[model samples]
Target: MRPMPRPAEYGQWDELPDVPEVPTSRMGDLAVLDVRERLIRLIDRRRSEDARIAELEQQWRERGGVGESPYEVSRQWVRRQTTEGALMLAGILDRLLRS
Candidate 1:
């Protein structure tokens, strides 16, 4: 394999490093904690949604939700759930960032 070029070789370095500093306020700390809690809640919500999705999928299959293939049905269910999860996460992130 060919060797990759270094970032500096492309003149990418600038005057300042692109690191973000931690906020030094009580609200900043509370915001961090809120984000953590929201993240945990998001995880739990995903798990529950996944389980419900699986149960519904099994029911659908049993009720003759057949299509071209079982994979097609499973993919549709996964896609729906993923879209919902993405939207939910985007909203949460927006709120957290604004705070």
Candidate 2:
């Protein structure tokens, strides 16, 4: 591929136009978005961790663990984890909303 072309006058950061100032209300709005994104990421992390825990339980069962089948135990464990995560997320969201 050919080399990309650069603008002849694109050298000075000081020459760049001044960025517009954001209003305080808009900053608050962005904070709400940030909170929602964080919540989503936290939820995804919890789900992945719960899945990992279930997988670990399965491996343990395959290694002659004495208990109910891996499927049953993992299901119950994942359920508890999900419930706890949900409660935690609710509290976090509540606190964020109150801010």
Quality of model 1 by C-alpha lDDT: 0.49
Residue 40, model 1: Cα distance from true site in angstroms: 1.2
Q: Give lDDT per model, in order.
A: 0.49, 0.51
In TM-score terms, candidate 2 sits at: 0.45
Top lDDT: which candidate number?
A: 2
Per-residue accuracy of model 2 over 1-99 as CA lDDT, tens digit each: 423223332221112122233345556676555645555665665468667867887798879898655454444444444445555555655555566
* Candidate 2, pairs of clashing residues: none
Candidate 1's clash total is: 0
What's the count of clashing pairs in each model shown?
Answer: 0, 0
